[model samples]
Target: MTEQVVTGGGRRGASSAVERVVATVREGVKTGRYVPGQRLVEADLMRELGVGRNALREALSRLRSDGFVQIEAHRGASIRRLTREDVAQLYELREVLEGLAARLAAQRIGETDHRQRLVAALESMHEVARTAELPAYMDENIRFHRTIVELSAHPRLEELVDQLQIQTFRIQFRSAAANHDRTGMREYSVTEHQSLAEAILDGDGTRAEDLMRRHLRHTRSGIMQLPDGDFA
Candidate 1:
């Protein structure tokens, strides 16, 4: 059953209903309230989200498109599970795409404001990491990376990165959960991000690209090292 209920009756209620239902399920998957391979029973979702069957199904469809849920004929819907091989494949593409974004961002980031935003993103990440808030930290981490992609001034590149960011975060979260030393991993993340920010700010495209690739490689290794059940 859903932990919270979102209801509808007003003029904007119908549209908002789907949005609320989607948000609930998306947040659940992100926070591990819904783990990988867990089936999302339609009736339970309808009651938990306080939405009708149609609205719940629509929400699940949206989640499925976002790579958060998988629906099969007869199997219904469940949180999408990632295999270690999936992790490797995703990271291989991420390293190339993100490395390119970082390089372009280094070349295009001439404005002081953009540089400051990168710094601010890193600062927010540090604050959340220090508090040991994994979800918040993950949000900030993605923000930091997305900011770089935005500053890259490559619209196509940003679109591509956006496509993979969510799934990548899903795997990363599970890996951190499986790791014995999450605190240490978080600390390591902060340091690496700070360094990447500095590299980009310094206008070193080559260094920025290399740093991004290396950082993603490390993340890939971390995820691959986790046991099978972590992502299951």
Candidate 2:
């Protein structure tokens, strides 16, 4: 009985270690610490994450399932790089999902403290935009969208949006980095974000949806215009 108990505890500990590795790797990819197509050395990951080979492999497997990593037969694991077609397809889905999230948030704006929170998020975006720091602006930009998703009060919708956002994180970061010098584009994005916030605050579901779709469409256009080398 004691052996069984110990075995169970070991399993839980291993699971926790795998989770830590997974979260760290995911955050690394999102923050650009791990760029697309970069090889992931198992020995390095094991050392850095302080996990054993088995736990590291398990974490990599989970990441692979989530479309964050790719394990080629002989090439080992590497960050998954999105192709041009992949970006286009992801944007197409994002438009629908995010638009729906915006509409739902607008419809439910008065049901909770979402109003205050959303206003705060928009203000944060404005403040970050003034700094002209790409990383801060990107962080606030993601926060603003996440606030709207939370306001939607739909668990499944939030989960779906979160997954899609994670998958596109690298692409979005790269696109933004490439256009970091385009001050006009940054200003325009902030303006559109304000317009989106207004629509949601006013509880105009239809307008909120329309604006969200339009915002994503413009972003997609900009990403498409990037040099061919940007995509796989």
- What TM-scores do the predictions have? 0.76, 0.92
lDDT of 2 by residue, 106-179 (tens): 99999869899999999888888987578778878887898999999999989788777877866776788888
- Top candidate (lDDT): 2
User: Please, what is the whole-model Cα lDDT of each candidate in the order they appear?
Assistant: 0.82, 0.89
Segments of candidate 1 deviating more than 4 angstroms: 1-24, 44-62, 131-136, 154-156, 181-184
**Candidate 2 accuracy as TM-score:** 0.92
Candidate 1 to truth, TM: 0.76
Evaluated against the true structure, the overall lDDT of model 2 is 0.89
User: Local error of candidate 2 at 222, Å?
Assistant: 0.6
